[model samples]
Every structure is written in C-alpha cells, then in structure tokens.
Target: MTASMTGFAAHSLNLDHASVNIDLRSVNQRFLELHFRLGDEFRALEPQLRELINQRLARGKVECRIGLTMPPAATLDNGLNPDILERLAHWQADVLQRLPGSAPLSVNDILRWPGAVQTAALSQDALNEAALAGMRAALDELVESRQREGAKLKQHILDRLAAAEAQVAGLAPLLPALAAAQREKLTERLHEALGEAGHERLAQEIVLAAQKADIDEECSRLATHFAEVRRVLNQAGAVGKRLDFLMQELHREANTLGSKSVAVETSRASLELKVLIEQMREQVQNIE
Candidate 1:
C-alpha cells in the first residue's frame, strides 16, 4: 500500500513519579531525516529511536519531541530516611555537648540534609523500556496516519491517471484523420509554391512531414506508461520514487505529442494530459 510522508502521532507513558509524552511529526522529504528533542536522561535512546523510525518509514523529515513531566514532591510517595535522620540527630546532640548554647536543628534543617528523604523512582532499565514502548506506539500511529493520507493520494493519482487515459483514448481515433488533413493542407501549400510539375516530390515530402507529425508513438508510449503507473500503484511498498520517474516520462510524452501536433484537438488533448500529469506529480511528492 502507498504511504504519505506526512503525519502526526503522540503517546504518553505515565511512570511512578513522572510522565513521558512522545510526539512524532513528519513531512515529505527526499530522504529520511530525524530530529530529536530529548533531555539528557533520554538522550541515550536517540539512536535506537532513529533506527525504529527508519525501520518503518522510507522518506520524510521527522521530528520527535519527548516531554518529561515530573510530579511535585507532594505527589511523590516519599518519607524521611530513618537511618539518615537518626545519624543527624546523634550529630546534633554531639554538637550541642561541645557548645552548650548552640541552637537546635529545625525541621527544615533536618529535611535539607542529604539522603534525608526517599522518593519512589523507576530504575534506568524500567524508564528506558517504558519510553521505548511509548515511542513504538507513537510510531505505529504515525504510520497509520501516513497510510490513511496515502490512500487518499493514491485515489487522486488514479483518478488523474484515468483522466489522462481518457485523453489519450480520445486522441487515438482522431490521429489518422488529423494526419490526413494536415498532409492535404501541406500538399496544397506545396502545390501552390512548387506547381503541378512538382507533384511527385511534394507527395514524398508530405509523407515525410506526415510521419514526423504522427503522434501515434507518443500516444502509445503514454498509454503504456499509464498502465505501468496503475500497476505500480497496486504493488506494495515505497513506490513513490518510481511513480515520480513515471510522471516525468508521462510529461515527456505529452510534450512530444504537443510539439508534433497538427490539429487543435490534439494540442488541447496534450495540454489536458500535461495538466493531469502535473496533478499526479504533485501528489506523488508526498507518497512513499
């Protein structure tokens, strides 16, 4: 299935004392480019996260922003460390014995001591695992979003392909008639210029000129290219580049058809073909 290179996804992981929010966004690009916004604690996982995105996506400029929100001390499951408090109490008593008039330790002073309070926290391994899981979920949703957009783009491209085919078909039946009329006009002009004695030479020149103006080959290649486009759209995975190349080929044929045109209808059909091809190319820029 086709996939667009633009999408957005967000996922949050709530741990014991903190929550991690992962936001992934992508826009069309010629290659896979990753930008990460992770704090020092999560920086180690950047390479792994980039690898995960590469495994799923083919092309885009992707930005991954990780937001970490730590709960307040009031929300934490914390309490004073008994061992540290006891040691501090003993030290304070010794200090009071040495200096008889020394001030007593206040509640704030005791709480301010190192290791005086313990708060619930996740281990490094646990945090890494949770963050990775959240990233995976966000990546999955991003891919799904890209796929939904891709489906719409594919339909639009196919519709344009159908229109182009119709234009090619419409021009096919008119080719012989157009060539005959153009040849008659050319022959008449040649007769006016070269006179009756030059009939044989004029016939030969008309045949050659008619061959040059024949849009049959261009029209045929266009139809073939259109069929290839439909086939590519049906096949699986990363067909954007291929489709882009096909658009060039289609445009080339349309240009050839227009350049060699003799009839107003053929020129208009060529113009129409070009318009449809341009529309498809624009959409193909976002496909993957």
Candidate 2:
C-alpha cells in the first residue's frame, strides 16, 4: 500500500549496558530531505541511518534524533579510572610530607577529583549493531504510521473524486437543454443586431455559440482523469508526485468546463469540481 509523508515514530532499545533511543518525524516536501540529531558518540552512525531511510521513503522532510544513555553503575568498576586515582594519591602523600600541615584529602574531594571516574567506551561493532537494530525497529513503526495516514488520505481523495464525478455527471443531462437555450438566445440577439437580412450571419453565429458552449469533451476527459486517479491510488508505493500532476490536470479540465458553461447549474457544478479538486490536491500532497 501507499504511504504518507507525514508520520512520527519513536523506539528505544537496551543493548549491553546502554539504551539507544530513536525518534523519527516526517512532513510533506517536494523531495526527500533528511536531518539527524545524534549524540557525539553516535554521530558517525548518521550516514548508515540516512541510507536506511532513503531506501524506505521517497518524499518527505524527515528528522531523526538519537539519544544514548549509559546507566550510572553498569560496569563493576563504575567507570572509575584506578590509574588516575593512584597518581592522585601519590601526589597527595608528597604534598603532606612537604607541607606538614596540609589537610588530608576528604572522601568528597576524592570523588570530585578529575579522572576519579570515567565512562568506558562500548565496543564499536556492538554499538553499531545495536543501533542498527534499534533503527530498524523505529523505521518499521514509522512505515506503519505513514501507511495508516496514507489510507486515510486515499479515502479522502476518493471521496472528493466521487463528488467531482457527481458534478460532471450532473452537467451531462443539462448540456442539451443549455446548448439549445444558448442557441435560441444568441440567434435572437443576432436577429436584432443584424435585421432579417442577416439570416446567414445568424445561422453561423448560432452554430459558433453552440460550439463554444460545448463541454462534453471536457467532461469526458475529466472522467478519464478521475479513473486514472483511482488507479494510481490503488497501486502500490510512492504516488505523491503522480497524484499531484493528476490534480493539476483535473483542475485544468474543471476550469475549461466552467468557461464553457452556458447554464447556472453547469457553472455551479464546475465551481464545485474545482473545490473538490483543490481539496484532493491538498491531501495528495502528502501521499507517498
């Protein structure tokens, strides 16, 4: 099924002693645009994450944020650097010997000392693998979210399509009557303007007026365009661009129908078609 460009998904995974959290958000855009917000440690993974997103999505302005958290006491040593502590202890002993009256280092002072504790770097291979797994989970959820929105968009577009089709259908039965009325009115005007000697001119003007008022061709083409819209909607995968183009075509037909309209009902139907097309255009902008 097709998907939408608007969606959001967040996922978190615990791996080893750290947690990897991913947030994905997307919105409609003419093209795929990706941005990442990752902690320094995971910054190098941006390229891989981008590649995965590009493979799955065709259009959107997408943002990805990665948060990594390490528990306070995940390791046995609690991230303490023993070598640095030993060096500090040696320095403190020398200072006490040299200055005799110096206060001993308190437990708070030891804990606050630089290098008293350090965070261990996780294995690169392991972090990468875990991050990739977490990303996959988030992406799967993102796709499902987009798909659900796409389904709603499809229904909305289909509804407008039906309304536009109904407008076109309503115009059909009105055409013959409108055309005859237009011919009679134009003929009367021509007779008044050119007198009885203008019979030839009146006939030509009537035929020309009838031809200008003809919208059957526009209506037929609109029907065909509607059918194509349905077909594209039902087909799988990124269809936003295609649907957008169809919207323009549909709008063109509606405009032409309005221009050729000879009756108030036909003109109103044409206006309604334009309204419906505009609504569909907005919805199709987000289809993927």
Candidate 3:
C-alpha cells in the first residue's frame, strides 16, 4: 500500500511509580532521519528504538519524544529499610559518644534516605520493556496514519494523472492535421525562395522538418511513464523516488511538445500537461 512520509502518534505507559509518554512524529524528507527526545533514564533504549523505526519506515524525518513523570514522595508507598536504619543508628551512637552533646539525627531524616520508601520504583529492565512496548504501539499508529494520508495523496495524483492523459490524448488526433499544415506552409515558403528549381530539395527539407514536429514519440513515452507510475503506486514499499523521476520524464515530454509547437492547440495542450504534471509531482513528494 502507498504510504505518506508525514504522520503522528502518541502512546502512554503507566508503571508502578511512574508514567512514560511516547510521541512519534514524521515529516517528508529524502531519507530516513531519526531524532530522539527521550529522558536520561530512557537514553539507553535509543539504539533499540532506532532499529525498530528503521525496520518499519523507509523515508522521513522522524522525531521520537518520550516524557517521564514520577509521583511525589508524599504519595509514595513508604516503608523502612532495616539495614539503612541499623547503619544510621550505629553512626549516630558513635557521633554521640565522641561529641557528648551533639544533636541527633531526626526521625524524618532516617525515613527520607534512599531505599527508605518502598515505592515500587521501576527497575531498569521493567522500565525498558514498558518503553519498548509503548514505542511499538505508537509505531503501529504512526504507520496507519501515514497509510491513510498516502491513500489521499495517491488519489490526488491519479486525478491529475487522468487530466494529463486527457491533455496528451486531445493533442494526438490534432497532430496529423497540424503536421500537414506545417508542411504546406514550409513548401510555400521554399517555393517563394527558389521557385521550380528547388522542388527536390524542398521535399527533402519537408520530410526532415515533419520528423522534428512529430510529437508521437513524446506522447508514446508519456503514456508509458504514466502507466509505470500507476503500477508503482500499486506495488508495496517506497515509491517516492520512482514517482519523482517519472515527474521529471513527464515534464521533459511536455517541454518538448511546447518547444516543437506548430499550432495554438498543441501549445495550449503542452501548457495544460505541464500544469497537471506539476500537481502530480507535488503530491508524489509526500509519498513513500
């Protein structure tokens, strides 16, 4: 299916004592570019996260921002650590024996030590796992968003493609008539220049000039390119580069038709073809 390079997805993971929010955004770019705005605790997961993104996306400027929020100390499920309490007690006794009248450690101080509160603080492994899971879920949504946008882009391009095809087709039937008129004009000019003596040479020059004015080859190649674009859009995976190249080819043909214009009809058709090709090219820029 076609995929656009622009999308957004956000996911949140709630752990025992904390919550992680994952936000993934993508925009159009020539290649896969990744930017991370993870907290320090989640920095270790960057490499794995990068791999996951690369596995799923082929092109875009992707940004992943993960925010971590922790509950306040007042709200933690608190409990005492016996080992820490014993160490603090021993140190307090030593200090009292030496200083005789020194102020003792407060009850609040003992309770506030590291590991003092049995806040089910997340372990590294647990946090990492949850972040990864959240990332995966966000990616799923991101891909879906891109696909939906892509569908719209594809339809837009196809509509312009149809218009461009009509422009080319309309010019086809008029070509022979245009060629005949151009030949007669050329023959008249040559006769005026060289009279009866230049008949043979005039016939040769007319043949050469007619070949130059023939837009049949350009039209044929344009139709072929159009078909290829439709085919590419149907197949799976990245197609932006291919579509971009096809746009160049289409533009080239349109320019050729304009350069060789022998009548107002052909010139107008060339202009219309150019406008339609430009529209399709703009839409293709967002495809993947």
Candidate 4:
C-alpha cells in the first residue's frame, strides 16, 4: 500500500530509570532529511536513531524530538572529587598565608568550584536498548498515520480518474457528429465563397479541413493514458512520480484536443478533462 508524506506520531515510554518521550513529525520533501532534538545524555543514540528512521521512511523532512524525563528517584548521588577538593584546599591555604588576614574558604565555596562534583553515570547499553524500543514504537505509529492519510488520497485520485473517464466517454460518441457538422459548415461556407463552378474543388477542401481538425487520435490517446493511470494506481507502492507523469500526459492530450476542436462540445470536453487531471495531480503530489 502507498503512504503519504505527512504525519505525526508521539509516544512515551517508561523505562525503569527514566521516561522517554518521542515526538516525530514529517512533511513532504524531495528527499529524506532528519532533525533530532535530544539531551546530551542521549547524544550517543543519535546515529542509531537516524539509521532507524532512514530504514522506514523513503522521503520527507522528518523531525524527531526526544525528551528524557528523569524522576527524583532516578537521581544519583553527587560524588565529590576528593583529590580536587584537596588541591583547592591547598591553594586556598597558600593564598591565606600570603594575605594573613584573608577569610577562609567556606564549604559552600568549595562545593561550587569546577570539577568538585561528578555527575551520575548511566548504563549506556541499557539506555540505548530502551531508546531503540521507544523509537521503533514511535516509527510504527508514524507509518500508520501516513498510511491512513494515503488511503484518503488514493480515494480522491480514484474519484478524479472516474470523472475523467466519464468525460472521455461522453466525448467519444460526439466526435463523429462533430466532424459531420464541421464538414457541413465548411461545405456551406465554401459554396457561398465560390459558386457551383467550384463544387469539386470545394469538396476536396472540406475533406482536407475535416482531416486537419480531426480529434480522433487525440481522444484515443487520452483514453489510453487514462487506462494506464488506473493501472498504475492499482499496481503498487511509490507511484506518485509515475502518476504525476501520467497527469502531464493527460494534460498534453487534452490541450491538443482543445486546439484541434472543430466544435464547442469538443472544446468543453477538453476543458473538463484538464480540470480533472489537475485535481488528480494535486492529490498525487502527496502520495508516497
């Protein structure tokens, strides 16, 4: 089944130590570009996360935001660096000896010094595993959303195809009548321009005129292209480009039909066909 290039998926996962919330949003793009927003602690997972998204998505500008919500229970003890503390103490003592009456460094001042306390370390492997699981779930949701939207787009295109086919069908039987009327009008005009003396030559001229204004070939090709479009729509995945090309072909045929129109009905049919093709083209742009 085909999918759309726009969707949104958000999922929150509660791991033993941390709760990970992932939000993924995508829109139509010519290529797959990913933007990731993650905390420093989760930076290690960026490459793997990108790889996971690339594997699932074929095209779009996808943005993924990862938020790690750590509860108070997950907070680790702030271990002081005893060696740095000792060095700071020695430096403070040396400064005090030089100034004799300088105030002693307070405990709060020592704790606030750079490198005095170490941040709690997390198990890289465990976090990586949890993040991957959450990411996979979020991606599945994204695909589901895209697929639902794609189904709607497919229906829209199919409806336009039906309308176009009906217009072509309506035009098919009118061609012969249109040509006959055009031939009659041409004969009358020729007879008025040149009297009975030019009857034979006038007949030849009418035939040539009818042949020049023939829309049979254009109408036939339009029907063929319509059939090809329906075939492509039913066949399989990633047919957006193919359908787009077919829409262009349909428009080309419609324009040719209009230019060669010998009757008002033919011109109207051509206009309707162009409208239907444009509608389908608009919807096809969002397909995957």
> Which has the higher TM-score value, candidate number 1 or candidate number 2?
2
Worst lDDT 10-window in candidate 3: 112-121
- Model 3, span 150-228: residue lDDT tens: 9999999999999888888888888788888999988887788767776678889778888898888988999998999
TM-score of each: 0.83, 0.84, 0.84, 0.79
Global fold similarity of model 2 (TM-score): 0.84
Q: Candidate 4: which stretches are off by over 4 Å? A: 76-121, 191-204
Whole-structure CA lDDT of model 3:
0.89
Q: Write the per-residue lDDT of candidate 4 for residues 65-145, one digit (tens) a residue.
A: 887666545444646778888998899889999998999988788766765654345466766777789899999999999
- Give each model's whole-structure lDDT: 0.88, 0.87, 0.89, 0.84
User: Over 4 Å off in model 2, which ranges?
Assistant: 80-121
Q: Please, what are the lDDT tens digits per residue for candidate 1 over residues 153-245? A: 999999999999999999878877887898889888888887866668888888888889988999889989999999999988899999999
Candidate 1 to truth, TM: 0.83
TM-score of 3: 0.84
State the number of backbone clashes in model 2. 1
Candidate with the larger lDDT of 2 and 4: 2
Q: Of 3 and 4, which scores higher on lDDT?
A: 3
